[model samples]
Target: MTAVSLVDVASHLPPERVGREYFERYSRPDDPLLRNPMFRAPEYRRYAAREDTGADLVERAAAVLFERHGSDLAGEIDLLVTHNALPDVPFLGSGAEIARRLGCRPAQIVDLHNGHCAVFPYMLGLARSLMRDTGARTALLCTAQTAGRIFTQPGVRRSAHAAVPGDGAAVGLLRASGESPILATEVRHYPDHAPDVALKLDDGRLYWEPGTSEFDVAFDNSKAYNIIERGSEIVPEVVTRVCERIGATPKDIDLLVTNQPNRLLLRNWGAALGIEAPRHFDTFDSYGNLFGAGVPVNLDHALRAGRPAGGGLVVMAGFAGAGELAAAAAVRLPGPDRPATPTTGGPR
Candidate 1:
């Protein structure tokens, strides 16, 4: 079978509504009562105001993707894939809505709601399969996250989820190709940690409960710890596997697009892996953690900032709701001669 490669990728954030200044002012000041500092960072607009919901982020991101590709809703898009945890509204799934807005037919849509690490790899696998079965020439893969809706709470002092979660969304276009720049992909799952990260139903509402005390006592105690504890191990392992399969290493990669859970986590993970942190592109400093959207959004930033030079590789990894871990690598295709412009505009 021919290896699959991502042909085009792009990302989007609501707008530059939140920034460092906002964080410094709002986040708790030395709240020693909780595991981590109380969400001191200024609350993101999506979380703070609730003006634009997760669905809104997805729509805006889809608009950005379409614009970047220089394609219209009427274009020849064969498949649409979206990775997300919190759908726009509780009742209707965001994937269907996104496809509708893009004018995609029902049969052409696929929704993967597997949380963090599983998203990228799952999407790659689905895209690969679609290419083989249907010979889909154009597939729109989008990951949209709205951390604000998930983490923030009323009168809750500090939350592990709050410390890192951010809001954002990203989209990518993939097509079957036999090319060097767009390389192969591999995926794996560690079922042992399945109970570590997850969302639980409480009074009919979904809440991110990173493994509770009872869960810790029952399962591997340490597994319930914050994502950082195992993140270092999981990320490098996946990266090594993907790189080894492709005959490349961290040094050869021009960009490392991982989940932007936290600045410190990214720094520590990069150092531990001996991979110079690829130009860290982040919306988390302002947006918070957009659960599934991290990788794709960052990839879009790297592309817009100026495509990395020859043989540039992008390593994307994430861990979300279900103690899930996902990682994939894509080489940058020769960029378009003309940079694409943003057709949709909003708060930024």
Candidate 2:
């Protein structure tokens, strides 16, 4: 059985100036904030709502991944997998739109619509299954989140929603290879608390009520709060299982990528595991939260930008709405056959 390694990764962020200035200009000194010191400054897009559509972001990023690898988009890929919660339109999944833009045929596309945690694991599992069953050679995996639409709702607390989320997309090429096969993957689901962190359809629009309230009556459940508390435990447990299956300790991990919710959650989880802080490749503070795209986006950023490169174990963990957690580990393959090159593509 051949192992799977991310052959190439690419990401796109909406223009980074508009939102940054808006926050700086309006944010108060006393507002509750979770600062991510790893970033010298926040990364964000200005007027992302008006500037770019969600499908546009995904297509642009995928174009870069193909160009960087010097692979022919039409010939190289046997399958395409997309993960997103808030897709561009109600009826059409983002995967189909991406495939259409890339000129890929209907037979080549599959859509996985789950929250943040569901995307990567679903893609990984699909790749593994395809390799075992159909002997497919290459697959394109993409994840994107356009939280701008969610946070821009009238009356929703923009400070809380906008502070953490940023719009972005990540794309990766996964191929069947003998060298770096995916070792182990584990996913934990906590359904009893499903209502805690949920996106609901109110009237005709989508609404996100992060936390529950006790006070009066309607829609006052603290689901978001419960998700955080339970997530603390879920993340550690999932990581432990992945480490044990792979016969590696948390200390042995060279890089750990967790869902970019906030700086505080990352720190708390790092402390809980007694692992020194791994190089945090975060886009959340600047981009806000990219929902399902979090892990792939971070991995793409770390790989493309310069980082200490040698063979070491890397962990990718995802935690999304409703206390769902997915964890997987891969040994960073020795640097590519040739030094990596910058991707040439249009603005995403």
Candidate 3:
């Protein structure tokens, strides 16, 4: 029996509105990427409001979930796991602070720093395993992407890739119940690509060391090509493996959601798996690249819009940080037209 299922998802996007004009001011029409069909200027209008200027994005998102579900849901969480690509506090994740602010005293707390964009499934896998092993009923998983804080800098903003990232947070509520049950999941890590995604600075100072040189993505042409190919391949690979685990195929999934890096990867993954555009969910045109929060945010978007209908099979799949980690899962979505209140579940 499945131990945990994603009962619901809620997202918090900042109030600020930025547009393609924001990036166009720095980049020119002659930019090679502008002409690439695969490339699209990030038109995400929201910013998480420079690091720490307001309530944490994760907190805001979770508050929405609790408000919609009930305050009691906050008290029921047994485990809380958080993944933020850019942590406001150095040497400390925002998990403890978030839990504190939300009035949740979880039995366990995890502040994961890696797993990147694909960490959504990784967290889901971790939640189910822990819930089963510890005899717990509920878990809260939170992911935030604040890449805009760094990308908006004068030094880095000139590059086109700088505009690819946006800011927001999405938190999912998982319970040990059949409501929105998770069917099967697969997670993989490749050490060869672990070092491929990195930060570059011309001054040769380590990221931790004090330096005046601004940082940017270190990807070169060879690394970029290899990463793109691996990304185009690995995501579908995991999705297929997951579907096959449950005696189905990607064709059986009613809706597909993945990290919204850009149009290139999105189109490639669907084409590779034969999933059509209508059945696939995308937020790139409005939300840009949301990093780890991308998938959950999209899931929340779909649910709020009353999409994929009820009793549908949905698949969430993507790779994280270059191509080092990938994960996918098959889920039986909740019924009756939209996300519903969760039923507390535990050991059978």
Candidate 4:
């Protein structure tokens, strides 16, 4: 097994910040179930990428990571894993595009289509496996979203549960090492609820389909309710499984960061896991649901804010909108005994 080192993480968001009142005035739905109670957010920053595309977001984040690390990362990064929460274009893969933009000619590029929840943890595991088996030195994991583009058109802005989405991109550099051990990683899929949450095209307009769980509705519960309930269940379960596999307990983790659905979900998850409020890093109120970008972006924010201790254990978790997919990873930060290496080409 290869020990993974988290070199560093970088993120980028567009300039325009939109408030909840803007969504309520222009995009709120008529269905009572889809009201602000369910949307449950105050504001989200939109990437002002009117003239740009999803690839631009990915490239910009990659550029930030490279600039922070300097020229050393150019040849050392051997793999590029790129993905986005929503499908922005057909035929072209964003991961490959980012790799091309960075001129990482020797790096193997893999594109993931798992959307928001499963991608980050899944990529972490894959990068570890690739480094272990293929002798790759480093891997760059990136998640980008151009979610604000959905509102560019006129019709169906008030579609069901069409809570305003923010746009952004995040990147992390990982290398094989024991300096910051990634204890365990897991991802699970629940196909039964796959269709409960999705994007649908209707009458030449894009609309979101939320809370349509047929089986759960029999219990007099909304599909959105069931999705949240299932998320509340699975995140903790995966955290427990990872802890047990690594011979660690929930109490042993020093920090927790999960995908941002809303402030309420983060609070509920912290309560269920018995983690203190400060241990969990939250960006929901400010950034909205960044989809796949949430985990890395929040992790970057937490690390920069000095939330996690040196040599401390950090647990990262994420779940899909319909609660159909889930993933978690446990990592121990480098401490004085094992100083973090320069986040460039070489392993610590």
Per-model TM-score on C-alpha atoms: 0.77, 0.80, 0.93, 0.88
Instruction: Write model 2 residue lDDT over 1-348, tens digit each, in one string.
Output: 666655566888766544555555544454333132322224564225555666788888878776655656556677788876556776777777788787766346777775465467557766667755766677888887776455444433224434445677878776676444466777766666655544444343423344442111012225435555676777777777788888887776667777766565677678777766545455555555566777877777766655426535667776766675455544454444533233322112
Tens digit of lDDT per residue, candidate 4, span 76-96?
A: 778888887555567666776
Root-mean-square deviation of every model: 6.0, 5.8, 3.1, 4.8
Q: What is the lDDT of candidate 4?
A: 0.73
lDDT of 1 at 183: 63
- Candidate 2's displacement at residue 69, Å, is 2.4
Better of 1 and 4 by lDDT: 4
Model 1: weakest 10-residue lDDT segment is 212-221
Off by over 4 Å in 3: 28-39, 51-55, 337-348
Off by over 4 Å in 1: 1-4, 19-51, 70-73, 157-163, 178-182, 198-226, 278-283, 335-348
lDDT of 4 at 158: 50
lDDT of 1: 0.58
> Ten consecutive residues with minimal summed lDDT in candidate 2?
212-221
Question: Which number leads on TM-score?
Answer: 3
TM-score computed on alpha carbons, candidate 1: 0.77
Residue ranges of candidate 4 with Cα displaced over 4 Å:
27-29, 34-36, 151-153, 204-221, 343-348
What lDDT does each candidate get? 0.58, 0.61, 0.81, 0.73
| Cα lDDT of model 3 by residue, 1-348, tens digit | 544778778898888768888887887555445554334566674677654522288888988887777888878989999998887778888788888888999999998867789888888888888888997888999998887667778867766677778888999888887767888889998888888888898899998899899977775556667878899999999999999999998898889989988888999999999999988998888988888989999988876676686558889988988798999978887556554543442111
What's model 3's overall lDDT? Answer: 0.81
Clashing pairs in 3: none
